[model samples]
Target: MTTSPPEPGLHEGEFHGGDLDAARRRFPNAPAPWIDLSTGINPHAYPVPDLDTSLWGRLPQASDERALAEAACKRYGAARPDMLVAAPGTQTLIQLLPRLLPQGDVAVLSPTYSEHARAWRREGHTVREVSDLDEIGTAKALVIVNPNNPTGRVLPVERLRALAADLEARDGVLVVDEAFIDAMEGSASLVPQLPPSAIVLRSFGKMYGLPGLRLGFAVARPEIAARLRDNLGPWAVPVPALQVGAAALNDDAWLQRTRVTLEESGDRLERLLKGCGCEIVGRTPLFCLIAHDDAGTLALALGEAGLYVRQFPEHPRWLRFGLPGEEAAWGRLEKVLRPQGQ
Candidate 1:
């Protein structure tokens, strides 16, 4: 495991969806159209409820947070009131965790989110990788991304609970970033378990396709949650985000339909990628990590043909593909894979 964190700062053409904003600006007239396969956001977004600006124009009030918290608990079956803390996005909560924990060493599961290690190291903590929980030792904190980003490796819930226990024994915090769990069949969300030293981060941006709204939440013991709230300050969630986010979370029929669509689309993507001679590593309900020695080149080729896939700079050999929304997208992608000299 690399004791030092990987290079920080965005690299050129690194395909996280948010990069599209810059891509569009740079390539005002790229030959082919751009299709974003970078971010693991659901292509189909939930229907945003009619916005009542008056209800949300001001900064989020305490009553508003309480209402949203209740909705989340009811939706995710959070058993306790102290378990959830809403944030502007899960990214914000994640960046804050290391700062909130007592000064000590930090261990992050590698080939995971770069931000986890980056955030810890940025705070002057020694960040290391843990392939398994045992490697965490008596560190100040252990961070794991359930259905880990890019890799899409979903750690079994039992293993996670055990790992949390190990960290707890050392009086350390266990932070589980469950950004993709909502797309899973049975999520291993720690939302219901608000253990004193455990924190779980959930993102509404990914599944709900409301990244523009910037909404997410943290689940921790009330005391920890209170500290996070105090540190992060009041009005963390804006009124528009709170109003629309609450409405979106309450839509059961939409949730069911979206889940079905994601499963089917994910299956199609996996099959298509396999047929293309790419090595499939692991996958969740949302995306899959694939490896080819020439992933960067292949991504460029796909981009030239109008598909924009994500490439991790550290692992140039691996790429992450978001589910293509329509068969036409896959058809075009497949067409690019045919033998050139045939």
Candidate 2:
């Protein structure tokens, strides 16, 4: 894995995956050819077709944007194309949402993505981290990451809709981040039943394995989406990203096959982690969260062997393992972890 510096503007305790430089600095003696399973991104990326040279020579057209939105709406089950606001990525939208909405108390489901809390707090909103959705009482805004990152906890759609209704009655809003939901079958998304007070964020990178393309969407009432679109300006997503994303979203055949592959890969990952004496706690099709008495130690051990897994400092017993992309990567993980089970 090539090394790069930590991303600029990262808050304390907001470390992300895919920081190979940090891994290298910490484990200098580790061998080359690092197996990076730190991020829950698909190792197999969608095949982006060759783009026309005109895509580069000219500014992205309004028609191209419309096509991309239409494709995303179809893929994500949004009510209409206008309901979706294309952005550079969900991370950008996450940072902008608190600013777009009225300032008030914001409750984020805890032990999940830290950015939701950080973004709200950054926007001067009173932030509360709650473990249960029922505990979110009276907050003006509620944020949830469905099939949550690192932990992989999934909240039922029925309960989420009920909460949205309750919040809407009080003039509040519910923001759902469905970044990992793409790989899960029969998962409920808020986009199809988008209430005026509910906003849903969808990621194009994780399931498609093209995080570099930096494409994502925000599905909500047209008014809210319009505001987000305005904030993002006229040409938020690059032309190449629009072309690649539109084609990938419209490819139903590839989506179906990839879903099955991710499920099988997830099962294989779960078994490998279990075999290493890690107790499985939660999982999604792209990753597994396992518990161990000394997760930090295990993470370091794996890192020193040129295998990088994710560890949460706040949750010392937890470690997250993303699916390996290739057979060699899986074999390397198993080889390094086998001694732990003994």
The candidate that achieves the highest TM-score relative to the unseen native structure:
2
Per-residue alpha-carbon lDDT of candidate 1 for residues 1-342, written as tens digits (9 for 90 to 100):
222211222232222354765555544564455677778888888888777758644777777777788888777767765677888888788788878766788889877877888788777788887777667766878888987987887777677777777778888888889899988766577666555667888889899877888899888877788888887887888878877877787788889899999999888888777777789987877788888766656665665666666666767777788876667766777777554213
Model 1 gets an lDDT of 0.75
TM-score of each: 0.89, 0.95
User: Residue by residue across 1-342, what tens digits does model 2's lDDT show?
Assistant: 332322222112667777888788888899889888888999888998998887887778899999999999999888889999999989999999999877899999988888889999999999999988779979999999998886788888888899999999999999999999988777577777777889999999999999989999999999888999999998999899998999999999999999999999988888878888899999999999899886767776788899887777667678788888989888888888889889
Off by over 4 Å in 2: 1-12
The list of candidate 1 runs beyond 4 A from truth reads: 1-17, 21-33, 326-328, 338-342
Please state every model's RMSD to the true fold in angstroms: 4.2, 3.6
Model 1, C-alpha of 31: deviation from truth (Å): 4.6
lDDT score for residue 8 of model 2 = 25
* Alpha carbon lDDT of each predicted model: 0.75, 0.87
